[model samples]
Target: MIRGCGRLLTMRTAHRVETVRAAEAALMTRLPEGALMQRAAAGLAAACFSLLGKGRVYGARVVLLVGSGDNGGDALYAGARLARRGAGVTAVLLGDRAHEGGLAALRAAGGRVEADDPFAPLATADLVLDGITGIGGRGGLRPDAVPVARAARGSDAVVVAVDLPSGVDADTGEVTGEALRADVTVTFGTYKPGLLVDPARSYAGALRLVDIGLGDELPGVPDLEALQHQDVARLLPVPGAESDKYRRGVVGVVAGSARYPGAAVLAVEGALRGGAGAVRYVGGAADAVIAAHPETLVHPGPPDRAGRVQAWVVGPGLGDEPGVAEVLASDVPVLVDADGLRGLDPALVRARSAPTVLTPHAGEAAALLDATREEVEAGRLAAVRELAGRYGATVLLKGSTTLVCGAGAAGAVRVNPTGTGWLATAGSGDVLSGLAGSLLAAGLRPVDAASCAAYLHGLAARRASEGRGPVTAGEVAGTLGEAWRDVRAGE
Candidate 1:
């Protein structure tokens, strides 16, 4: 399921263009020629009819921004369905050629085909269907279609994209050039990467997947997976009757400097609620951590001086710290973040006997990859995968769409669907690192720990921000229990 927020949701599996095409080809061979298109058209029309509200289809002004391929055909056929229901449907053919049969169907349904200025029909249009380019069309929209695309955006009508939005890479979620932004995207068969990963994900406002009977033909593994509440709930650790604090798990946190004592406190705060039995704080901010969390065991200097810990979360606000190497040397899962991520040696991380997870924002990731922050943000999926491969760790690239890519597992990347804008506040990454580290200590795999931590962290941010305007890092930490309970609700 494409799980998001605090509940179970639809299948969030996304496929690449080639995978989708192969599945479609197989499905088409078993069905009638135009049957697939008809199924898609029916779903699209039903979605639009719902979007326009009850009794609004009759006399509603609908405009189709049609191009050449099946994407345009889907729009045309859906437009025909609207026309048959008494809507004033108009198809503005942007390409030189149109889908002949789709055009005929629209004409038969009394829909007008506009070959002249497309702007006139858009003025009073109640709905604009973007069908300019499909999954195969790349490098953005052609120069000829720019003005018309702008007009559609400027219109008061609800802009709906057919399949993938025009100008976005279906496989990579990259918007290389000018593209159309839609209010809602009605995708056929399955979800595409562009619809889930940002910056292309932002272009696809709200996603609606239409099952066109291709589920059976798609492969067992998908390109991406977004965890639902149930998935996260299943991964969370539950204590046994005989379990003790150490027996449960101990999370080691090496964070905060004298200048950033609050970071240690915040990290410990998150760790306490992250299903771990105990937290061990080893850094410069021991006093602050003790003051904030009296239950935490504190150490003043090096990490080896501290008691045993199942996992270590090193680096949030640790300005010029020396414990990263010491922490990495231990035979335990290590989560490196913020200051620890600075000047991290890939060979050192790669040689670790235990699993490692790296959580970096766009800027840190860009620095690590020797690329610009803009480039990392533009192509997050690629950046995260590359970081995982290079570091030999499960990399969690945090941004608008937080992604987790496991080392040596190139097939499926986990996309955190619970992320919110409010989680971008200061010390948030610190909280996330500690939480993930706690999960790791609780025996979750590096990938599962990272994914579940991100999921709960985002969900906690949402819970903290609800009816509260903006939320602080501490507030997000305070709400972790509530978010955990929300995920485990009804279980």
Candidate 2:
């Protein structure tokens, strides 16, 4: 784990081609075309051998699913290396043209090509290299190649993808059609967005980046970033000796109602656990909130009388309540979530002077954008950024991987790294709202607060699970302190 300043270091998708081309150019300048392929082959062979957990490659059966380009060539040469080590190697060509030089190398090393074999020694193979397509592939798996990929997937052998899992869009992180699910994906040069984001991210089971030395030419700025523990630790606010409760920053939460008081309790819990100096609750659920957390200052009134605070969290369990509009109209940085997302006027929000952060799940985001949930889900990044630009606010789209986008000229998007599928449980959004609001109150920018809070919240859920069973929203809030410690300690 690398520790650094509050800033996060991430590999963006836009710069990937530049990085690859620079490395390819450098290698071309110094080495012969065949020489670079040999080095890549050697690296692949070493990785596969290590993964086998056995010293001898003599009896191991290896299957290479070859494509048309350099990616397929790498696999072919690697197959040749395995063949020379006494491993039985078979190459299944999925393209019209196989790498001529690579095929010659494999034959010289005693590897066999079986292009039409639907079941080419895959079942008994120790490992399968999916060289079907690389970063440049589009649409879906070629119609003819789909069934063969299906056959390979049905096998018991561990699957490794070269560069990326075929059929996944490298730049946008979109999965077009039937994609190969790999046990591990060995990416070259730099990380692709598909390897980091969801949908496509789910296919790339585990990711390993092989340096190949392309760091120097990467762009200075990234379009998106994933925060590590050290990054969050530096961003977290620590109280000082001179800091009083007011000076430390006050978070005002306007949430819940007579019908749903639990949302208020959960939100307060999230705020208290988030390291805020003080929490101010103003809603119909004041009594319920006080019952859950005695430290919170509960005010059974409207948003106008909520008193002065650095930040506000509106919505959560706020069911048809009219106070949502008043809260949104406040001068402080505000976070809108759950029911508060309904009937929001984009123009009014855009006209506000203070920063606003909207945390919407798919359905709510759809309502805000006047689009269907399916559309929002399909184009999550575009939808969130569009919302941010429309409302002149920072938007945090929560799902498998939360996406944070800042509005205006200095806009930059960030993808959250800390999350587990378990955090999908109910009432979790309430907790997230409170946590983000607290960070906003603590004086961090909307982008920083939303991204950092989401990272910590997700980490807490994972920590609470401990590789066991289902975890509740309360359990997630309880684990926030430990999550904070873990991030600070670089765990």
Candidate 3:
């Protein structure tokens, strides 16, 4: 339950399991034998001490769920450090054989091993260390350890996981079976995909990185990255002194029908607040959009006739609109979202020379991929990558954890860490499409526009809600300027 201001705001880079192993091996060769494990143990112990509060380490009841290999060894060594500080530490071994050196160190530090009634100590425990599995463990917890994991969860102890929670896929972030949920996970070297991507990400409550000095050993391009406030600030467009409305950029909106005019209003709201100098509105909802935002330049014809825009945002609530094809034909960057995603031609998107962005929810993505919604949600990373490759466009897969993959699906996928549950309201995606389209018009690359838009959209939602209740799409749009200022302040 240790909270901090830096965790969510910092740029997080996650490497795959194979990459992590290679980095650890390279670093281990340079360091002395057992030195790496000692470093991990020291960091783990310090994190646990902080969680236990000042002057609370002594006489605290601590239980360690130890398993085989280095994961258990890290826990055992950390537990020994706590035991030496006068804490009542107990280890419940769940694997066939434990690390010998770690076991010896714990016994010497006056920490006792529990063979009988392991569940009894958990009832009164103040802290529980989950070392039953590491990043290598997959397909869920073993049958033998299921009961113990449940008991640990049922207890009032603040559970801390070593490396990562057991039974979760480290690379895919998929929890196939039963897994242990941790209040805090202390990882070494670098972040794993499981710590950032959902299903597995939800299980890892709060993440703390313990630097074991593996920076140079890792690869230059990470598997995944999360944008920080400073990163967003750097990407945001700043208007020059001589910049005019057209010089900044103009984003055209081809959205809404007679029935869903609010969608048009919301999209226009987002575009006006986005980095673009001006927002152009087309389609049947021009009256509604103009009534809400008088600053918009309205057009009564198709997007091509809407007079020169740098980018077009199409398909927010067009029930039976015939503008998707027209918008796709334009040379400017186009953002296809909501109704625009329905029956979108991959060939048309691929043939375009300019950049294209597809923003789809799980259902729309499932439709595009011809897969079930459950499949898309379960394997969001694979879904987004496959979609990007198929359409040759930058894809933004929106969910509890938003993911953005660059065109061709070749580089590191950017994961947005600022999203809150309150952003699930209707018309929010429309706002996001407008915002991202505005960035595209402002001359940002496809990936940069999409990721920066998501960062701002999610941040605005968080600000509007203030962690108290639900937030409307209009409120989120209204708060965009505040979020933009907040990001710039970090720089």
Candidate 4:
């Protein structure tokens, strides 16, 4: 997720409460009493120092929201360091008690505690440190701290969250009630799952990880993994000197309908740009498909006689009675999206001998899970896992935070790191479906195809949007080749 030229970054994530606690305890035993906390404080102070720009912090106002835990202590110690350097540091304690040593350190460093009217100074403050709760915090922010959090947001001051944002679930990325959003989050040790997964990830803007000696303590296998560009480039199918139309892979597109011939064209457009050698078009919109792309191999009927293909992409705008049944009956890998997700039978999906991929947005996932869209969006990790397990397929839940989940307990939920808010445009998911299906046909596993497609699709959208602008599905599809080249070059 970090942007550095000529660099490939794969950020492994762990969100389990027990896992973090265990790693912390193991490291604590090897270090001095306050060594770890001091390291965190030093790192946090440096982050704030850099954020203050080239100007000195000497008269700048820095506010700390101290809670009852070590999170508060981290903030307080960091604030003390800032205070020692001449910053006007103040702590607003929310709980009945505060970290005793942290309070002493601040007092000795010339920082004072604000017992009343914390919001008064916050309006003119230069920075606000939210140490109200640690990563272990559950549910949301308490009622008493709500106003201060709101004031911090309202003010022009830069807000820095210590560890994970308070009220955001560290494991699930579920945000309930009030949350203290930060412009930059200075996380200690390793990246928490909440920092990578969305809804909560969006709260953690511009993440910066600080090494505090927890790398050795962390386990080998992480709960989550986000695919980087090099990782995807390795999985992309490359044509060889001996390769031909049948050798590389052929993707079959069974999309669009009488009502929406444009969707078929878009799907074919995505497939053509994907690693597939050629694309086979099926369904009633053959005339429109051929008109849009003469290169497409058009078939006028069901896919049963559509000739041989390596993979099938079904759904898109194919209406209520989407011919997903006939496509699913095929032996090759099948990617289901849009209307194809309707009336889907879990048993049929589970019974398939070939790999199955389900690409769904929040609404589609909610329908399959028999849950509300809000609930699904709130718990994307849970929803994707449940769908993968229930249907025995690889599930790619698309949104601001695109995630792919694989079947089996050992499967690591892959989060797509590259995406733009502008990608929420219409027909985007159809393009994603076709692209991922084409990858599946090109010999990548279900998980790899789904994740690689998401990564490239998102990258394509970002490239199509440039730094900032509105983008359409066709525009995004048109730029897939550029995105692919960038990924390969690690640009």
lDDT, candidates in the order shown: 0.90, 0.82, 0.92, 0.88
TM-scores, each model vs. reference: 0.97, 0.93, 0.97, 0.95
Better of 1 and 2 by lDDT: 1
Clash pairs, model 2 backbone: none
Between prediction 1 and prediction 4, the one with superior lDDT is 1
lDDT of 1 by residue, 40-89 (tens): 99999999999999999999999999989899999999999999999999
Instruction: Name the runs in model 2 displaced over 4 angstroms.
Output: 1-5, 9-40, 408-412
Clashing pairs in 4: none
Q: lDDT by residue for model 2 over 1-491, one digit each (tens)?
A: 11123655532433344446666777667766577667667777777887877766888888999999888998998889889988888998999899999899999999898855648588687889888998888776898888878887899888888878888877667776888888888877677766776777888887776766455655566555677666677788888768788877889998999999999999989988876789999888988998889999887667778688999999989898767778778888999898888888988788888999999998888988899987787677777888888888899999986889896524457888887889999899999999999988888888889988999999999999887969999999999999989988888
lDDT of 1 at 398: 94
TM-score of 1: 0.97
Residue 431 of candidate 3: its Cα lDDT?
A: 93
Candidate number with the higher TM-score (2 or 4) = 4
TM-score, model 4 to reference: 0.95
Give the worst 10-residue stretch by lDDT in candidate 4.
1-10
Please give the distance, in angstroms, between residue 187's alpha carbon in candidate 4 and its true position after superposition: 1.0
Q: Candidate 4, which segments miss by more than 4 Å at Cα?
A: 1-9
- Model 4: C-alpha RMSD to truth? 3.2
- Number of the top lDDT candidate: 3
Q: What number of backbone clashes does candidate 2 have, counting pairs of residues 3 or more apart or in separate chains?
A: 0
